[model samples]
Every structure is written in structure tokens, then in C-alpha cells.
Target: MPGQPSAYHPGPRPTTPRRHDVIILGSGIAGSTLGAILAKQGVSVLLLDGGVHPRFAVGESTTHYTLKLFRLLARRYGVPELEPLTSYVGYRDQIAPTSGTKRHFGFIRHEEGQEPDPAEFLQFSPPSKGLQTSHLFRQDSDAYLLHTAIRHGCDVRQGIPVENVELEEDYVAVIDKNGDRYEGRYLVDASGFRSPVADHLALRKPPKDLKHHSRSMFTHMVGVRPTDECLRVGPEDAPPIPWVEGTMHHLFERGWFWSIPFNNTPDSRNPLISVGLTLDERLYPKPDDNNPEAEFREFAARFPAVERLFKEARTVRPWVSAGRIQYASSQTVGHRWCLMSHAGGFIDPLYSRGLANTAELINSLVWRILDALAEDDFDEERFRYVEELQQGLIRYNDELVNCSFISFTDHALWNAVYRIWCAAEVPINLRFDRFTERFLESGDDRVLREMEKTAYPGLPVPGSHGYKALFDEMVRLCEAVDRGERAAADAGKDLMTTVQNSPVVLEHLGIRDPNRRFVYPKPEDLRRMAHWLRHEGPRELSYLTTGVGVHGRPLPSALDEELAVPH
Candidate 1:
């Protein structure tokens, strides 16, 4: 009965609704992963998916924070299978062998009818060479997670769309397209844009106030050449990492193009590449023809280097075109139902924050769900923090990406604003890394729980006043540029000045200096940062000193010795 859903029942279909402790719509990675954790914990779960496995899906990138969350989830929930997803080595060996290894995040800015300028680029790698990230082959990864849930005793239904969600005083019922009913103590809609829980509750609302406005069209493809091979840059002008080894962003004035290759690694069996173009709908209005392929070519043709990068590409599936991909809900939870992650809202995929946000939501929400199940309490008040966290994450991302899009108009502005993002990303990763390292060392749930009892619940660097000030100023400057009240050049100059003086700016990275185009911290840089953290770093970042490991070595002296370079 555990692995069986209504779709795969061998015997006669039950007339009575199937009952479970939790009923989740959409068996994508989010729902399946949640299902696996809950099922392993002895919570009866039913996972419903309208689609099947090995399907083409986007959002294929991962950050250090994302992978760390995977490790934490695996250890904390006792789901050892998830351990493989926490690193490139584990994923390549135990999971999808063809998944891409992401060593760095690279952005190359281009202008109309011109080759990319070597100086007008940015590359940021995790400080340690050993801490590799990944470009997910989502189809395989999603299927793997779903089956993991099944093996852990979570029932699943595939190819059955939920037609309606009925929420009552005690339980929730899901009615499928074929008139089958499923009942559970609680319902969670991890289903994307067309979330039945959101629809039933009339919670889906267009985020018109959201400053970020973008349309996206994406598909998996073969024959797309890597930028390293396509671009005519000399070794002296090359980025710190090969462009093919990570997610590449080809930025222009009004939009950006992403290239994620699954064929980057040596043992990779997959030759497919994930390709997409996202444009600010306000700047590049949708045309009447609605041809995504033609539109992609037209945009690429403007940037000479970008055109060569995708010249040989062939789409394996029809491109998915979306309009203004931002959406928010009036509420993410009700009496006995909740909208999980993307079901609640979504911004653009500029920084690959989707999965990271999903991880945060799961980490924060699951404990509450487990406790409520134990207590038999379904009060909406119990989930107030989850809603707030979701909203805060969305709000923060909206400004970050909205400013990023605005900054794309000029290289100087983009350089300054880019550092603003690093200010938040670096510290937050360190914070999570430190806590995760401590938990792994001590096997203490309290270490992970300590992360939740923070004043800023959903943010990466919630306690840093300097980060907040920098982010606030960035929003102000970008908003001023948007209003045509401030020139982009002047704003960039002002931001650079502020970044130079900002306490959140890590001195060793030289991000505050506009001349440093690539931010790759060496072992010595880590040692310097460790020293700074111990002495000069802000008091708010003191939490970063607790068991923070770098490149498989502990902080301070241990890291220094492990990474010592010969004189």
C-alpha cells in the first residue's frame, strides 16, 4: 500500500477516498523530497503528479547554499539517499552520471553588433576548489527523488491532475480529473503555476507591484557549443574558470541568455544543454507571432558573441514561452492546506535562488508540519512564520533581480550592483556552512534549530546591518534610475563608493574595488578572511567562526596548513 497510488492499483479501485496524513499535489523534486522525509519519519503521504518521470524541466543550477541545504536535510531527516545530491562527486558517482559540474558562476556582458569585452565580465567561484556545485539534469534527478519517496513508503500518483481541492474543518480532499477522491489530514500544493490549492482558495494574484518584470522561454537542447569554444578571447582575457564548466549568462541591454551544459564533465553521458532567454517584458514587448525560437535568434543576432555560442544548437523539445513569470499568493496557508514554495510565488531564475528558497522553506516548514501532525492541530496560526518567510524571500529576490535587470544597461552599473549581491551571498553561505559543519561534527539537531530562531527568518544574511544598508541603497539607486531621476553612471559611482566603505564588503575579495572583474578567493584569501572574521569582521558575523570548514579543512590554522602554497 505504500508504493501504490490510485494510478497503479492492481486490484479494483477503491470507492472511498484514499486517506493519508499528508496529501501533496505535484511529485516534482520539492513534493517528492518532502514526501520522502515525511514518509521516512512515519507520516503517511500521498504524492500526486500530473506528469511522469524523465521529463524536461528547467531550474537546473545549484549554489553552495543549495547543496549545503541538501546535506542538512539528509542528515537531519535520516534520508541518507539525499547525501549524494550534496556534492558533485556523490551526484556523479551515485546519481545522474551526466549531470554538469558547476565550478563557478560566470557572466559575460555584450553589446549590439559587438564582441564581448574582456573587462566587462564577472566570475565568482566558491573560495575552496574542493567545494564544487552542479548543474542538475533535472529529469533524472526528479525521477530519482520520486522513487526514493516510494521506496521510503510514500504512495504516489502520476499522470493524474487534481481537479479540485476540498478543505474542511478536519481534513482535506483532492478530486482528480477522473473523479477519484483522496483524503488527508493536510494538503500541500507543490504543483507550479496552476496550483489547485491556490486556485481553490482564490489566492493566486498577479504580482503587478513586483519591480521585476520578465518573460522566459527555455528548452533542453543538443549541439549548443560552449562559450569557451565559441568566443574569440585570448587566454589573458579568459575567466578564472572555463565557461563550459558552469552556468553562463550572456548579458545584453534588455535581457540575458543562459547556457547550462550537461556535457561539461568527462564521464558525462548526456550531450544535452539547457538553453533559455529571459527578457524584461517592459523593455522587449511580446510580439503577435509568438515564436520563441525566432525571437531567441533575433535577440542573439544582436550580440555577435552570443549568436556564435548557440549557432549549432538544436532543440530537443518545443520551447516553453512564459509571460511575466512573477506571481504571488494572497496567502500561502489556510485551515488545513498550504502552498509550498513555487506554488506560493516565484521570481526570475537570475541567481538560481528557486531551489535554495525551496530548501529553506522545507527546512523551516517540515518541523512545524510534523509537530502539528503529532498534536492534531490544524490551526492556520501555526504556519504564520512560513508565510512570512516565503513572502520575505520573494520580496528580497524581487528587488535583487529587478535591480540586476536595470543595471544590465551599463557595465559600470552592473559591476557595482553585482557586488551588492555578493555581500549577501558570501556571508549567508558562510553562516549556513558554519552551522552545517557544527551539526555534522556534533550530530546535534539544536545546531540546525539555532538557525531558525533568528530575527531575520528567511534571508541569507539577516543579522548584518551593513548588508541591509547596502541592499537598501542599491534598491534606492536602481529605483532612482528606473524613475529617470538619476543617471546610471552617477549611480554606479555612488554605489562603488558606498561598497568601498561598507562593513559587509569582504576586504580580501576586492569586490568593493570596481577594477576587480573576477572574484576568485584563494586559500590565502580564506586565511585572511578567517583572521578578519576573528578580529576586524563585524560583530554580527561572529557566528561564522563556529566550525566553519574550508576545502575539507577547519577554519583558521587548519585551513592555512592544508592550503599552504610553497614559497
Candidate 2:
């Protein structure tokens, strides 16, 4: 039954040339999700892919922000199906059974030929209970979204590689390998790194100026054991949660390895683990044989803990070796055509930002696209903001990941830099949850549009001056360390001091405490955060507690008494 078409698949590719309102390249999650929304709104969409579904793919992690965006999209577009993807319980009951639960982000730092120190690990969970993340089974998730698009009347073509794209003044023409021609009033290239639209237009920036430099080798495997099985630490030193309960990142100097299990839950039927190793290309150059599985094994052998974890594992799919995973396009939007997120640019998967970035782009893009379609206006100027936001995302992510790779050389620096990541991620994710809450309560699209009119283009919170100032200073210190002007230890101390003094960081969360390895906020912690924001915190972040509790819901009336008491 592998590669078989589902009931929602549109059967039989049409031989005749056809015209559509929008022609999308790549039927992966982003493209297919967009296609489904547009088609549901009565627009004709043509979705094309070079391969069929139930295939191996990566980008298998999700975050709270990603799920929040999905809920917003589902609500705003009247597509209730997307709601199921927003939570673990809903996903297991309504979606596929093969995906895994991600209750936290687990990171364990290691040194070559040494047992990983218990103190070197850190685990950060959702702000509150019941906020469940996921390790997506991309093969099934993609196929499901593609099916949704087809059910919404999107004409789809699979296993048909696009040969060429001709972008004219008013419409775009696509040529297939079999000499079939298709036309559309607008074109969108989500085809990823080897984008046909980007290639035809020569939109790639020559000698890519990306600051991050890394290569990756990835594949699916069986018998990949959990990190808990290999740890030498006792129960008292054990991580707060089981290591198998979330996405595990085994990091070393200048590189890292990811293990995402699909069989984490008791009821899960799948037995595969999505494994990948990303290395700084400058440190570990390409091998002669170019066999990725062999390369991965060699890299894992350097660390005793990593070696034990993978000793019994065997790959079930062909390995993909990528040289320099960073890429950027000179232009993201042009006359009668535009490139999707991955097509526009991509950085390393260090922080799992790929899917989150894609979700952000779609939330801002789809509405403008719908408006343009109604007016029959395909001017390049109409999508100017999309272009700006897309470019800014690439620039910001490049710097973030570039700095992270530099920090990997020293654990103290890596630990300090990670707090900076939390500073940006936590507040922004809280705001996103707030946005979803308001939209769901009032059914007002303006609540969502507020996300688009930001003073900061690519940064998480648009108007929060407190966090932005701290972030800028942190980057300066990190850059100094990278340039050999500052000692890693000194820079790490400075970074922690900055976090400790910043008004934006909630002290109750213990983010400023270097000794605290895990951050799982309890109800009392949330109450303290709310009280501080309401009474003691700076005005810049006071808005975070306006109508919602720390959990992005209305505060229980009884909690007022608890908020008044000191913890």
C-alpha cells in the first residue's frame, strides 16, 4: 500500500493544458496547506510535485508557535480540519497514529571520547501544562495536507517534474518534462533549494553571503535507542522528564545530532526514529565515498554516549548528504511570480525554525494573495511586504544560527547564548497564543492583522523595546567572542548578567539562573509572572498579561487572591 493514493487524492492527471488562478510548485506541507485554503475560498489552484506521497522527508519537529498559527489559519479560513493539528490529543485522535509527542526540547552537550556530563544537559518545556508539541511524521502529514487540498478542489499533479517557467507580464507558463504546458495568472515556487522559478529568473545571490556554514546527512532508522539508556548519571541527576519523551539534540563542538522518535508513545505503531547529523563543513569536510550513513557512523563514534545510543540502529532509507545547507535568494517576489519560504531561503535546523518560519509566512501571505486575486492585480509591488519580511527572516536566522555555531566551541558560551534564544522565543510565543485567543473569542480578523503591522519586521515581538535592546547587546557580546576580542567565559558571564538584569525576563521562570537546567513553570510560577507584569514589571511587557493569564487564557477569578500573596 506504499505510495498508494488516498481517498482524497484527485485521480488521473489530465493530458490537456489548463489554466488556473494560481500555480504552486511543491505539494509539501506549506504549498498543499496554502492550496487547500485558496481552493476552499473558490480559487482554482494547480498543485504540482516531482514525487509522490508517503515518501521520506525531514523538518519533522513542531513548536507551540507553529500549532498556534495552524489554529489561526483554520479559524480565519473556515477550515476546521486544521484545528486537530494544534494539540497532541487532537492529533492522535483525529490525525495519523505514527507521529510522536514532544513535551519538551531536550539538549545534552558532549565532549569527544568522554561521557556526557550530567550538568551539561538542559530541558525546557511549554509554559504550562497541556500545551503539547509534536515530532511530525512528515510523510503522513504531507500526504494528509495534500489530500485536504484535493478535497477542497485543487487540481494536483504528482511525479511530474517542472522543466521550465516563463514569467510574462500578466501570467506565468510552466512546462513539464513530457512537453505539457500549464498556465496560471500567478506562480508560486515552493519547490525548495533547486527552485525552478528562482533558477529561471537567476534570483539566487551569487557566492551566498550566509553567515552560517554547515552540511547535513539524514535518514530514517530502526532500533535507535533513547539517550536515557546510555546515561551513566544516577536518578537524582536524571533529567526531570524521560529523555525519550521529546526531541533530543546531542551537541558537540561545531556540530550536533538530532534524534526524533516516532515510537515514543505506548500506543504508537511506528518503530522508526528520524536521525540526522549536522556538521560544520569547515571542520568535517566531505568524504571520498560520499556515503552518508557511513559518515554518520564515523561522526557518532567520536562520542562514547552517541556511539552506545546508535550501536543497534540500522537505517531503513537511503541517506541524503547535503553540502552547505544554507541558501538565500536575491529576490523572493517578482512580476507574476513569488517564491515560498524554503524556496526563498533556508538556514540550519539548529532551533527548529523551519516550520515556524513557514507558518509565519503563510499567515501574512495568504490574505494579501486572496485580495490580489480578487482585484486581478499581480503587480510585484503588491507583495512588497512579503518580500521584505521573507528577506528579514533569512537575515535574522542566518545571524542567530551563525552565532550559535560559534558558541558551540564552548559549553559556557553555548549555555549563555541559549538564554538569549529563550528570551526571544518565550515572549513571542506568548503573544502568538494571545492573538489566537482574541481571534477565537471575538471572531475578528483584525486581531490577527495586528501581527502584520509590526515596527520590527522579522524579530518576534514588533514593539517590545525591552527584549529588543537586550537582544542587541547579547548579539554584540557574541560577535566579540566570535572575533576573539572576548573570552568565552567572560562573554558567557556578560550574557547571563544581561539576562539577569533585563526587565523582560520573568525571574520566576528561572531563565536567568545558570544553575537551573530545566524550566517548567508551575501555576504558582505563572501567578508570580502575572503579578510582576501587572504591578512590578516594565510597561513594555505589561500588555502580555492584559486579558490573558500566563497561559494565554482568562485568569481564574479565584487566582487574584493567590496573585496577591508572595511566593
TM-score winner among the candidates?
Answer: 1
Candidate 1: residue pairs that collide: none
RMSD (CA, angstroms), candidate 1 = 5.0
Put down candidate 1 lDDT per residue, 177-252, tens digits, no spaces. 9999889889889998899888888887767767789999999889898899878878888877888898998898
Which 10 residues in a row give candidate 2 its minimum summed lDDT? 1-10
Show model 2 residue runs off by greater than 4 Å. Answer: 1-17, 128-130, 548-567
Candidate 1: minimum summed lDDT over ten consecutive residues — where? 1-10
- Global lDDT of each candidate: 0.82, 0.81
lDDT (tens digit, per residue) of candidate 2 on 1-567: 221111122224345538887899999988998899888877789998898997777889888778877877897887887877787777777877888988788889889899998887888875533447888888988888888999999999999999999999888889999999999888889889989998998888854588778999999999999989988889987776798998999998889999999899986778999999998898889987898888899889999999999999999988899888888999999877889989999988888888888878887778777767777777889888889889888887887787777888777888877877776666786666566666666565666777677666776555677777876876788789878999988888888888888888876877888888887666688777777877998887776666553335674332243344431
Query: What's the count of clashing pairs in each model shown?
Result: 0, 0
